[model samples]
Target: MTAPRVDYDRIRDVGPDRAASEWLLRCGARVRYCGQQKWTQDYNNLPTGPLDRYKIQAIDATDSCIMSLGLAHMEGLEHVEKITLSKCHYIEDSCLKRLSQLEKLQKSLLEMEIIACGNVTDTGILALQHFRNLRYLFLSDLPGIKDKENLAHLLKVALPSLELKLNLK
Candidate 1:
């Protein structure tokens, strides 16, 4: 199957947070809106109200097919605090780079977990330096990462307050 396409017109119509939620849900990812307790996973059952009423707070893209291009949906999200990416086949180092460049996410994102994503390497981990407010990071099972200790040390130096956990071999 082809990768899911982003609808820019939907972003303009429903606002970035809602549009991103739709894209993520359509790709089998779950999203938690700010002030909402349950994660929204069904594309057809999306919440209804004012288009701009809900803000995306967290994304759990475990085993989803989200790719580098799909990360564009997150560009305008300003309230996202956490993201978990596990076993996403299409996610790559470039995806992380694209995520880091999002100005709104830089200040709001606090925690991130990258697990079992084969294409991710030290290059992608390093891109997280741009998230100035990020406090916690978890990485595991990424065989592409070659220099674990050095990369960990570099991240420590760059983000002094960050709590990092690694389970690489």
Candidate 2:
């Protein structure tokens, strides 16, 4: 099934968790069981595998009305190949920690943009070392990540072989 077009207004009334769930469902996510509040709950709620037979290749939640913890709900979207979180000021180290758990993205994720997120620090940037297949990464205007030189060095040591195009400023 072709993914449905994202309609922010259609999900504006709900909480972030609900918005994420609505996104998955509307994107033609195929799962065994899915209910209104399933993505909000625990254990049984989160899908262990891909949301659909075909992977959700990309998601751009740039400046979306959602907080850091909201990322937890997206963990179930196991096959995401690219994500853009640019200008989402509320996203911090914790959100990156949550993203690091997406082991499937380690080899599939090709690009990621987290620019202008004020709270992302070295800890968060380090967490991204897991994305071994990442060919492009954008990180700019992050206050928590103060030492650019160190960060560049770290990324080099961490992702030596990958020809990553970095946009860090």
Model 2, position 22: C-alpha lDDT score: 55
Per-candidate TM-score against the hidden true structure: 0.96, 0.64
lDDT of 1 by residue, 142-165 (tens): 999999999999999999999999
Candidate whose TM-score is highest: 1
Stretch of 10 with least lDDT, candidate 1: 3-12
Q: Give lDDT per model, in order.
A: 0.94, 0.61
Q: List the residue pairs that clash in candidate 1.
A: none
Error of 2 at 109 (Å): 1.2
What TM-score does candidate 1 reach? Answer: 0.96
Which segments of model 2 are wrong by more than 4 Å?
1-54, 163-169
Error of 2 at 1 (Å): 37
